[model samples]
Target: MTLNSGRGLLAALGLLAMAGSLPTFAIAQQAGQEGTPQAVPVVVAPVEMRPVAGALDVVGKISAIDRVDIQARVEGFLQDVSFEEGGTVAEGDVLFRIEPDEFEAAVTQAQGQLDAAVAQQSLAQVQLDRAQQLLDKKVDSQMTRDQAKAAYDSAVAEVKVSEGALRSAQINLGYTTITAPVAGVVGRAAITKGNVVGPASGPLTTIVSQDPIHALFQISETDFRNLRDRASADPDNVKVTVGFSDGTEYDQTGSIDFIDATVNQSTDTILGRAQFPNADGVLRDGQLVRVKLESGTPEERALVAQGAIIADQGGLYVFVVEDGKAARRTIKIGNTVDTDVVVRDGLAEGDMVIIDGLERVRPGAPVLAQPAPDAASSGQIPAAETEADAAPAAADDKG
Candidate 1:
């Protein structure tokens, strides 16, 4: 072959080799691009409509409906203590017995005097009758008959006086036995047997009714005005629930029974009272508790899981999926009920709020959203969220 033909042949071979490798390189580059990650996976829930109440929370104290102090009415040595300390008692039940020797003797003396007066009155009546008969026959003077009549009147008056004395003596005798003035549970006795007791003596014991208890609380003037306005609009809407210091909630619900007519000058607050049916006797007098009051009729409000809420310098916000993209929205918040918060503004029903994978989410970022596990059974997002998720929103909103 010629030199030029040899060179052309070598060039043709080189060209063919380069063409053979180009398709493999192109395939590798395409595979690498296809392996890149997709949008971040997230859990989301839909906003819901629920009935909500404007509620106020405050500290309160439990008190009894009826309380009394037991004291002696008469003077005598306490011969016997007839009741068990810290036990239930009924009205008119005897609690103590004082020595009755002196009182009994006075009663006996008064009775004897009354009997003697009655005999004297009988004898005087007989004498007056005889004197009247003699005067009719003109055997006795009119002066004698007049004297007999005066004696009979005097005896009648004496009988009445004796009767009064007897009644007084009997009352004093009855006072020797002390009885309970009301039905309730009695406290420890201040006086025991052999102690002298009288009206001047201090209270011997205390008794307090055990059922239908009262819960007393105080509210600021502003809150009181709001409550009064709400009450005026709906009188039967105010309801109260109590919680103990140990984080236990009371089962029975109560109603507001009283509000003080005058405001307290020192605190600038008003006193309020709620009545609770304490059939179980779980409540006691002077017990500190947490009181929550909900007033006004139930109204429709938008609610979202607390986890879905977010916060920034501007205000509280949340991320919602729109057209498969995360959209940041500012929201106004209201009272918290359970795991959900009432969204006063900026959210609508059926809006999908990002709950899980919040750390990976950003405003305007694309997301692959799925219902949270708790909401899977309902075929939608849950109505409430964990309290930990709600904390940031509360702080940002200053709620």
Candidate 2:
């Protein structure tokens, strides 16, 4: 019995020694794990709210309300183009003068004849009066009185004929000078000095009325109906602003003045015109421009930085960080402005978005969001790098 007990004690001692060696083996495994480094951190931003305005925009053209082609009215060699090409002129301004010396001489000859006729008429009247008085006193024959009366009448007719000739000559003389019929800025003079021009001749120049200019644009019937409905419903007036082809907005605002009564058959578009006070004459006729037609009461809208939008196989999307993980979200977008886009759906205020290091993120990846290092320094990021993306990624995880 004593021998058996001694063997059992020795077995228990060996088992204890093996258990101590097992702890050292576990320590080596733990040391190896501690040697590796952890992943780097990512930055993110919370979803923020901003205000936007509702607007309707379309491409339009600028035009002069009144455009005129000036034609020559007098027959003569263009003595002098009194106004410079592309100069402003007023009504009754003389444009050109024809040779008038021949017409003047004709008038002088008519006047001389009229004077001689008057003198002859006076002498005939004296003779007629003397003959009449003699007849009254029975001192002369009736035939003699009649002859004097006939001479006096013939002299009066000669005087009347001479007066008619004088008036005709004077009128022909006045037709020599041509004058401006309207006030406006004149275009290139088609006829120069010494060029023969007449009433039958073609246009001499063109004139465009610059003040109270107009902007012309066509919109579909659907758009027109929308505008009309708004105008009728609201008491406030509809306003419009214009932009040039190069994306510069004009400094003026215009009101809708004229709308076509019927839609165009071929185009199905309604013609509309807006007037502006272009006193400086900067807006030219037929220049292309973009017009924003705003109607109804303005409403507040959700706007995101333009840089925050992303595209994928599905559609436009953005990334947001939530609970320290990246989440992807799809968004419905609306009008885009200078550096922002109006979001019609799929986003809200106060959501955290991932803007920086988007490439390092994936759906459901763990993230450590710090103040986006790049974002803190610069607020203007590319569309892909805006907070709208990061906030959705962060907030989407909650949904």
Candidate 3:
């Protein structure tokens, strides 16, 4: 390098270093030449008001509306199990058959005794009539008539006793053939054929009614009060729908039919039961399910798409374009319905929220807002594409 050129370069560097703000002044001049900053483009939609109802979710257990235990009413060897295990049975259908030989013999013996008693009663009545006739004709003494009357009365009492014994035998014979007390699905047999079963035996099996099944659940007392307030006439009639653990929803809806008389003090919850129609028998006893309750009259609520919601350590927030500038709004949210979320606070109807191109804008920055293609005044969200979701939308607007 030439000595003169090297000396000149060193002198320039020294002058620039001595006046450091000279570079900053030159950059400011360059920015002035560039004019105004361009406004960021954003997609926007309006907030909307829609009817919403309060909801509560709780776990439930399926139960039969009517449950019965089958047992032998008479003592004898079980000759047959007349039902298929886990099969449906109609009321009055035979479920078991105990050996009938002994019952039949007792019935026969009792019938014979009743016949003998009837014969004796007739003979005694004839004797009493003859004795009375003789006394009226002065051919028999009063004592003779009286004695005949006594014998007749005794014979009548014996006949009455025998009739009772016969009825008892017939009842026992009927009991030997066990019948279902209600129409329901039967569980596994506790005893098999050839086993001795009688009144002393425990339940031979169980039966649970299927249609109009019960879903048992628990609710806090506060919730019960809220539900009752929703429907004053029927506290238990609050509407409920069920879902399975696998996220499949039950087709039929249920209503609360019963509330336990007492509260479970330890848990501070009251037991509630909802009845659902199960004509297809899809609901089974002891099954677990999710129960969602809808209560209270529908109230107007502002709703926004779930995609517009943003959460952070400070809770949740969304963006809106206000006065031609991108604005941020912190929101308190409630239960979500479909893709729409209930906005409990921090937003109002007709608010233009910025939902897209959020990465290019900041709070209070100029934005070029455009309507989301699916946007509408109604609470329904415009279907969106191209990755901008989780906030409101806005485009540049003149203040």
Candidate 4:
């Protein structure tokens, strides 16, 4: 071969060799990228068996156990209001006073009439006795004796009439002072001092009992039947919990003490009432609230944190760590109690559900799972194991 041709041949061979190495390098780079999958860090909690309550949610209103409207029974000017406006008062406490001048004068006149009737009765008795003695002696005529007896009887009747009048007048005098009929907190005074108030007056004021308030609600016929069936098994199982408008729950639990016998004709609903102690005065009359009526019977069910749930067009779903990877699961959620949701289906005990770092997770992605602080403390998993399992995955991510 010629020198130039040999040199050209060697260069062509080298070029072919370089072209072969390029594809090998490209394949190696692709393989490396595929081998190291991204590990998503997530906080997880194990599905646990807890006692979940079967409950019905409804809206309700708070009401006072006892309410009364104060009114003046006697016609008089309001002399004074003895109770503080919007303050608590005990039963039989004087709430208002009326002018007693007229009532007192009536009582005095009645007493004077009674005294006169008594004197007349005494005189009649004396006359009757004298007539009887004279008739026994044959001095007085029979007709005169009969007249004296009649007069005595008339006097006795008059005395009885006077006594009745006195009693009525005394009652009227007592009515001048109006007192609280029930122990409760008094509302604004409708009739202030110096205003003429009488039985015809609409109302002087209003009072409502504060403690042991009532929660009134209505339920559909179906719900009523369900409640009846549940209550038949356990009469005292009807428990109620109330939530205020601000989303804070009332501390006290109540019992279902009243249920109407007839369903509402217009709405086909049944009225129900639950009584709760309101010593703290947190509940107010006629305030709208949310009510949760739960059966006391405990039920075993799998539960997960509320934050773990996600939704899509299909329905509610959650991400569970399976084989060290995130797997999407469609769950049938039942009732929610507090911060946990009852899982009716599609979840098993011991499954680790992702509660935190869900934004970074995708289906089938490798995960660096660690038990949430709350879940770890609940004995679901050991804290040391969670930390140990997370360390290698974190190092791999860094590397």
Candidate 5:
């Protein structure tokens, strides 16, 4: 062969030798020729079994169980606002007062009518007794006695009617003073003093109960089913906890009280509600919070680094080194514990999950696996061999 062609062949052979002898080591970083596939170096961590508490997290909202809209029950000019705006008030406390002059006049008029009726009935009773005594003494006819009895009965009926009207007047007068039906924090008065308000004037203010609060959250349909099934077997109490955006957790835990009967077709989720004791008024209405729901006893589960997970159209997956090659393993993941995610399926203990150098990896590609620094200290299984001793030997042979 010509010298030029012979030299070109040796150069190609040396490149091939270097590629073939590339070692699996943490520090090795190399690529093959234009069309040849080469081993990709990556940091791996073994799948571990961890004690998981089976906690599910979701965004929730806080609200009050008893929210009352305060409105005037009687029609009158508002004479006074008795309570401060945005302050706490007790039950039976007077919140507002309407003009009582008209109501008081009505009550007086009713009382006078009742008194007049009672006086007429007293006169009718005297006349009926006189007619009856005269008839017995043969001084009056039976017709005269019958007429007196009818008049007396009519007066008695009138007195009863007047008594009912008086009671009605008293009730109307009582309505002029508005009182709180519940002990709670009151909102700003919608109608200030001197404004005319009545039953049709809408709410004058709103009050929401503060001691016990409620949290509402959504759960996926799939997760809802799993939880229901587990509940049937376990029958244990499910605990609820909440945290705020400011990195503070609620001092009290809540209990699940309700789950919606139907799922939201648009989101494929169902609503779940929990009630908590919020004595300090820490839980307010319409506050967004993080809710964690836990149940059953802790169980050992396969866990992998959360950073290793990847998502595609099919679902979540991770790269694992199997028999010196990178393979794709589809995984069904559950709740997160610390920095790892619980793997429901598709992985087992001792499986080396690729956590670093994933950008250079492909399905079925040969990979040089090395334990991540943290994983090594945590006692992960050591790699079969290292490329620390491979590259130099290949170079010497090429020389």
Candidate 6:
């Protein structure tokens, strides 16, 4: 019986030893499984520095410098029209003619009356002199002398009145022809031949000066203030460039010609005007255009891919790859150019920023850097690579 009990005890000891060995073997297998290196795929873009200019592009319209409404100054019936519709004319060019026969006849009648008055005055003067001589000889009475003097004065007054009438008739006759007041392009005439036009008839046509033009546009209050401040710093720096609706750029540069004193109450925008030389008449009045207000010089700033930025609770941030790990960094953004953004702060040139797989990246995540595909390549970013980057670095080691 003692021998059988000793053998049972030995068997129990062997079982306990096997159990200890099993635990060690399991631990060794787990460590071996964790020794493999796993790569988490990610997309990266090189940081580039570029020039950024602070400017605001605004929409505007073109307008002529001088606009006039043509009207007749004197009352007359239009006898002949000499100007073609939409034709260019010079100052003092005859545009219309009124009938001058009545005016000329009035001048003739006034001249006849003045000649008769002059003859009567001469006779009256002779009568007065004769009366004075007879009074000296006591042949004429004082009453006759007074009568002759009165007749002479009346005749002289009539001559003066006729002369005045002749001058007025001449002026009226000259008013028969209508001439252009200023040199410009003439629009369609509102009145035709036989139409009586005068000051009361309003404008007979419209004219606009096209040698020089103005571009009118509105900008936000903020932009206006920025422009003013920049101008104040450097008196001759701010320049305005204009572009047409068809995307063609204007060669002539313009200066700020006008600024409204008061801001527009309804739109909160300020009205601005720029003067441009249009000697060739290339710019027309009331043409809609785009204005680029360049307030200052270009500034060197950091640039990054526009898609690399991610917005969340941390605000504008980018995933920077450092030491082969996904690092989240906040950045200050400046002006945007095409598909890239200018960084004012929080980034340096040549920093690798993740352009793809942002959804799978987080702080301290392990990332396998990959070049962004060129435009010629297929545009698909693989889903498996995205999933791998989303997993933890420790998980990568375990795999």
Best by lDDT: 4
- State every prediction's TM-score relative to the real structure: 0.61, 0.57, 0.64, 0.67, 0.65, 0.55
Number of the candidate with higher TM-score, 1 or 3: 3
TM value for model 5: 0.65
Q: What tens-digit string does per-residue lDDT give for candidate 1 at 113-201?
A: 99999999999999999999999999999999999999999999999999999999999999888898888789998998998999899
Residue-wise lDDT of candidate 3 within 180-263, one digit each (tens)?
A: 999999999999899899888899999999998999999999987877777775755466888887666789989878889999
Task: Report the error of model 1 at residue 135, Å.
Answer: 4.2
Cα displacement (angstroms), candidate 1, residue 350, comes to: 16
Number of residue pairs clashing in candidate 6, backbone atoms closer than 3 angstroms, sequence gap of 3 or more or interchain: 0
**lDDT measured at residue 37 in model 5 versus the true structure, 0 to 100:** 51
lDDT of 2 at 268: 96
Best by TM-score: 4
Better of 1 and 2 by lDDT: 1
**Which ranges of candidate 6 are over 4 A from the true structure?**
1-61, 74-76, 117-160, 194-196, 217-225, 233-236, 257-272, 300-399
Question: Which regions in candidate 4 have their CA more than 4 angstroms from the true location?
Answer: 1-50, 300-336, 339-399
User: What's model 3's TM-score?
Assistant: 0.64
Model 4 residue 198 distance off true place after TM-score fit, in angstroms: 0.7
The model with the greater lDDT, 2 or 4, is 4
Query: Which sections of candidate 3 miss by over 4 Å?
Result: 1-51, 232-237, 260-267, 297-399
Q: Against the true structure, what is every candidate's RMSD?
A: 12.1, 11.9, 9.0, 7.8, 9.1, 12.0
Flag the better candidate by lDDT, 2 or 6: 6
lDDT of 4 by residue, 1-399 (tens): 999999999999999999999999999988877777777788989898988667787899999999888887788898999989988899999988889999899999999999999999999999999999999999989999999999999999999999999999999899988899898889999878998999999888999998989999999999888876776745378878998766668999999888888999999999989999998788888999989888756789899988899999999999987666789999998766777778999999988899999999998777888888887787886443364565565456446
Better of 1 and 4 by lDDT: 4
